[model samples]
Target: MNTQDAGPLLEIRRLTTRFQTQNGALNAADDVSLMVGKAETVGVVGESGCGKSVTSLSVLRLVPSPGKIEAGSILFDGEDLLSKTSRQMEGIRGKDISMIFQEPMTSLNPVYTVGKQVAEALLVHNPALGRKRARDQAIEMFGHVGISEPKSRFDTYPHQLSGGLRQRAMIAMALICRPKLLIADEPTTALDVTIEAQILRLMKKLQNETGTSILLISHNLSVIAETCDRVYVMYSGRIVEESDVFDLFDRTLHPYTSGLLASIPRKNSAIEPGKPLHSIPGGVPDMTRLPCGCKFAPRCEEVMEICCREEPTLADAGGGHCVRCWKFLGRKAVKV
Candidate 1:
């Protein structure tokens, strides 16, 4: 269903998350806004340390010490998460919303068997579930995620499983409760191409089966292209551009989004032997002390005088395609 016809499953409006650093307070997520429709797979794409992970963590109120949600609201199914108590969050975390963290090896417990780890959510959320029932359900989930010999693998530790298997175990754990929304933070970062494709396909299939909305966070544009229905392009902790998947590729706006799209390597496209691949110029700004204007002004090729003087807000260009750029704000490009 289209977004207009049905309300969003998760709506984050101007959510700002800050961290207390040596330099001072850093805005890890600055007035970030996005939404995930029912059963929709939305993606957040950007370079490393661009607040993709922080945005997801803030939704679940999982931001660690030294970091705080400074402003705005996170609305999930019409309820404001920021208003919920920590004890109330425990009931919502695994049952209604779940997260598949970046690294399975580190996210999974080495001390516990995979079965115990996977079943923990079920046992915690549903106290009526007995140990044997939880174990059986966990094994079933392992099979669903394509683990070999699911029964035997249930007893295995995270170290005992292969990289792909460990990832599958993590997926099983995340999906065990059949959550309404799944926030996957670079779920396929460490896997091989073949395994990555398989995992993506499996996630899509499960999403179809369970009608679970997904908020996928990754730096890989290709991965986002392969799965997401809509995309948000983030840079320096703020959303720069957002559009449907096809519009993003076909009619990309914002210099930063264009730069990201241009950097993707195309196997079929001819490449000159000595020519270097295109990369976005300059580096991400310091979060503790970001520039007064656009965060990407230093790297933006089509940057104008206004870009360095006045920060642009996300304005709709048409068809729900929004961009945060001075060019979209009717300013003429002035090359320095």
Candidate 2:
């Protein structure tokens, strides 16, 4: 894919997802939009309950019961995914877009072998394929994901594999059909450091080989920095900031983005014991009763009166960067 000519494989526009709760239906993902260009990686980062997971589920139209995509469009290959029927979605699910979930232990079935699980993915997409061919392809996918002696492993059950191997199996299963877009939601949360690095590298390798675009959802800034070409910072169901990875971390325009970077300790930071610890302060606002001004205003140290009176709009700051903040609304930051 040429850098300049690449078009978005998946484009989310003004997508809003609401879930029914005890209080009322709340926007788990509110008017969030971003693009994943061909062979590109887009990272969605934020704390837990900040709509990171909800956004991905909405894109895949897999929102849990009691949740609905209230408005907006999800375009894949220039078609509206939100309007598709369940049968229509089935055709696109694995053949065009696939997802690797957070935990393989819970995501995988205990009753089936690792090979059977991966083979099932293929069988679901291509029913014409016989079980024998599906089994062979499953073994082949295991090798593609770096499992040694894939044929032997094919007969092994998920319980027999280690945590890293199970994750590998999950990745293999997800990519068996070589889908155009891959949505990986915290795919490495359960692995150890070494295995996590391996899985990341494996995904990168396969992506380059197959020209697959990826949407990686994670809380680890370092992981996002290493893999994603672009990123979105979400807060209280809204995308607060978005830009190229280098510009995002180096010259963040939103206060929430700045606080996220500040929370991560540098290698040379001086360590002091219990010196009033550092954090953004305040819990995630109640979804049903979010502040009228800014979702993050209650926790922002630099909050001003205007920040509490009006909601900020995502506007162009410069160089394809977008931020929602009163300070930068309708004008670029006059940097000195």
Candidate 3:
């Protein structure tokens, strides 16, 4: 796909995914909308349980049982994915859209050789390749992803490889088919800092080689800043801010975004010695009993009466940077 194309490769519109629990239905992803242009890396970032992972799962129609996509349209290559049947979606998953789940140790089948698992992915999508050819391709992919001694590693089981190698094998499986889009959900979560850096670099390198759009889900703002071309800041199952990566760091609008940036430790900062790091005051709200109006109002430092009474829409502030906060909406902040 040409990067210059104006249309996005994956466009999600007004997505609302809900999960049925004993209490009631809770919105895991509420009215979410985002896009990934061809060859562009878009990030969905927030703390855990903020619905970043649910949003990605919705894109692949893999929200898990009991969680239903109540309303939304996921358009991939100008085709609506929600409208496709299960069999059709299966065909598209590995061949058109692939995912690297958060934990490789849990995601990879424990009983099978890591190489065989990767090879199985290719064969599932293209069975005509035959086992021998699939194994050959899988080994080639292992080498491509920087795994040492691909031939020797082919017969090694998942438990035998280190965390980094397991992750690389997962990546190779996801990219073996060269899908149009890759959904990486916390791809580097369990690795050391050095391995994390290598994985991030490898993804970028592979993107350049394959021209695959990536929808990267991560809780770490630093990772998003390094890997994403554009970013969507999610909170309480909804997107509060969307902007170019550079603009997001330079001119943050939402208070939540501000809080998140403040929490990142700065290397060159002149803070007093032994000063503790800054952290957001409160935890994520309970989804089933979310606070009325602005879901983030209770935690927002600049909370207004209007924010507590009415939810703010995601509106453009200026220059295509969108924010969902009363402070940026030109509304007067009445004291509580």
TM-score of each: 0.95, 0.93, 0.95
* lDDT, residue 201, candidate 1: 96
Candidate 2 Cα deviation (angstroms), residue 106: 3.6
Q: Please state the error at residue 144 of candidate 3 in Å.
A: 0.8
lDDT of each: 0.90, 0.88, 0.91
lDDT tens readout by residue for model 1, 206-280: 999999999999999999999999999999889999999999998888999988888888898787788888899
Mind giving the per-residue lDDT tens digits that candidate 3 earns over 1-336? 223355889999999999999987799999999999999999989989999988999998999889999998998988899999999999999889999987997568999998899999999989899999999999999999999999999999999989999999999989999999999999998889899999999999999999999999999998999999999999999999999999999999999999899888778988678988788888999999999889999998888888898899998867778999888775533433
Poorest lDDT segment (10 consecutive residues) of candidate 2: 1-10
Looking at model 1, the pairs that clash are none
- 90-199 in candidate 2: lDDT tens per residue? 88887789999778976689788999989999999898998999999999999999999999999888889999999999889889998988999999877887889999
TM-score ranking of the models:
3, 1, 2
Stretches off by above 4 angstroms in model 1 are 1-6, 331-336
